[model samples]
Target: MSTVHIVGAGIAGLAAATWLLAAGRRVAIHESAGHAGGRCRSFFDETLDRTIDNGNHLLLSGNVAMMDYLRRIGAEDQLTGPSRAAFPFVDLSDGSRWTVEPNAGPIPWWILLSGRRIPGTSVFDHFSALNLATANADATVVEAVGGEGPLFRRFWEPLAVAVLNTPAETGAATLLWRVVRETFGRGATACLPLIAREGLSQTFIEPALTYLEANGAKIAFNRRLRAIEREGDAVTALDFGDVDVSLDSTDSIILAVPPAAATSLLPGIEAPLESHAIVNAHFRLEGAPAAVIGGMPFLGLVGGVAQWLFVRGDIVSITVSAADALAEESTERIAELTWADVAVALDLPASPIPPCRVVKERRATFAQTPAAEMRRPGPRSPLGNLFLAGDWTNTGLPATIEGAIRSGEAAACAVAT
Candidate 1:
């Protein structure tokens, strides 16, 4: 009969509620936004006359936690990916194209095969990734992988930026290496590139809401957590602008909001404050862009303002991670520059940029620098009945869907015990 008052309706909160509700525990979700998914949701853009996600997100097959969450919501079939682990990349500066395909087994003998590896990279260069795996707390991606090399420029740097949302020169190496260990280290089976087949909301959010409601979980939108009243090491009440909900001794609370909101609500709590921005440009294309092997919907880009391209029907969306510099540019200018890269990568004409919608997620994620990584707090707080869950928590991984899901599960487990 214990009810859990969950704050926020993002993936973290939804994941937490889903787990608790499935256990026959009473659960309620409160969100400030009118809709769910926080930064991972999609909306209809009139300019493009199509639905587009606020940001482009991808998941590897190794994301076991997220896969399990999707299975719980009966959305396991809503994601699409390539049959194998292959990353097709194009260098706009020289028009050279290549796909880094890892072998089935873990040893990665594919590095010795010219046809399987990136051009100008040798086995010795491939082995340099070991530094990343063993990087210490103070080490950076550039420090672990070295500064100037074909492999570093073509592979490690982009992966670091995309995963960490921090510049390679200073991004924490441990995060990148953790990603490598979980996905690429497992084998080709675990590294298959996966993304939402329709949109992030449809695949990750809406279905979760549906499942939660069907299981007797109540969700309240626009009921933001204004404050938390504490009475001697326990959350006594939650203030939601117009009303305050008092909690009994057996009731528990899950703080699933962003780090800033958590810090504001709880005293003497430290969390990652430095954040990175991401820019996504969605263009209404005349037709689908060429796919990577096995009809993968996304392509990696180098030597351009954009980093990743996602093609859905007649829509082409560009994802620019670690986009602090680019996020400051005008929306029109970002569309123009991103179109140039998309045109080259997709082999399309560069004239008359199609109707484009630019989504700039300022503070998309915490800066994954060593200093910021040290600031991440764990789920347990001083209050006995309170627990925290978010990608920004000490999940021992970068801010990703997998990390967020894992964090929620961790909090739920902690609260249960």
Candidate 2:
């Protein structure tokens, strides 16, 4: 069997390796870093004396690709969340709180109830979603939905920023609409939140590595691909910094690195160039499982610097998405600002922030503007035997775990043929 050479042992590469290996194809994964998981992993923070994920992510039941990937790697039981769809939100300005709880079925009858909707939002405000269906591909979230109303400020803006990882003013409306159609449109059953029970590496990465190794797959860490040696429409060899890997005629390659890395390896490839940043501040609090919001593990915040706050045990992680400007601030400043928001949301003391570590993922995700979205390429590369797999690729979704997994699967399918 021709071995499938996968570059970058991130989620995309790992996902592609698993699918191909299961199909009886020989697989070898090479990663530049000694570790896998790329952006979706956890690490110990000495300051906090606890393991903290680089960024907090909230997955929904409607994320079909991610769920399938987890099940395949036998990590389906590694997640925990509310029994139903309950999104707790707080307005920092007025100290108001509410939970957006969708009904069990696809019909969003819950929106009709004032208590279930966002505070100060009328029942007719929910009708703004209808505009999404008619939104053209070039429409931004602000343009698609009239950006003024209370519903847009309290609901759409936050949701768009979280989903697209870009300001709602420039976020691609089509991508946000697709997310809404998949999760919220399907109702509470599909929108049920699922977060890693332990951590990202434990739930998504380590299990996948175990499965791949158990199935006799080769995982080579610290083997960076310096260049791609091509021979007329086919990848002939891969040049690492110290060693060069010569590919056989029958063998195939899967390039699953980030867009910038991919472009360096295969020049002139169309990919999202502009990217946004995400700032996360993890604070270690005193009590075990310090707090909960509406029986959910995470809480959404409006009129604050922190967009979302996630609690796991005594550690609280505050996330600010599309935070390019915030990412530039000093770590101390970021921590202080985020901790203030956390204090208000969690009803903790305002003074003396807990032991905290601020993480800034500068290129966390590509800019999900309409123009950037249009630049995303498909799985098929110019080389006949080489395929591309990454969240940044044209997966018809934002750069997310679901999109990353789907892109890998798409690459695997393309390689198989």
Error of 2 at 220 (Å): 1.1
lDDT of 1 by residue, 264-363 (tens): 9996898998898999999997766666434668888989999999888888999999999999999999999999999888778898999999999999
In model 1, pairs of residues that clash are none
Q: Give the Cα-based TM-score of candidate 2 against the true structure.
A: 0.99
Point out where model 1 deviates above 4 Å. Answer: 292-294
Rate residue 301 of model 1 by lDDT.
92
What residue runs in model 2 are displaced by over 4 Å at the alpha carbon? none
The lDDT per prediction is 0.90, 0.92
Distance from true location, Cα of 306 in model 2, Å: 0.4
Q: How many steric clashes does model 1 contain?
A: 0
Q: For model 1, what is the error of residue 156's alpha carbon versus the real structure, in angstroms, after optimal superposition?
A: 0.6
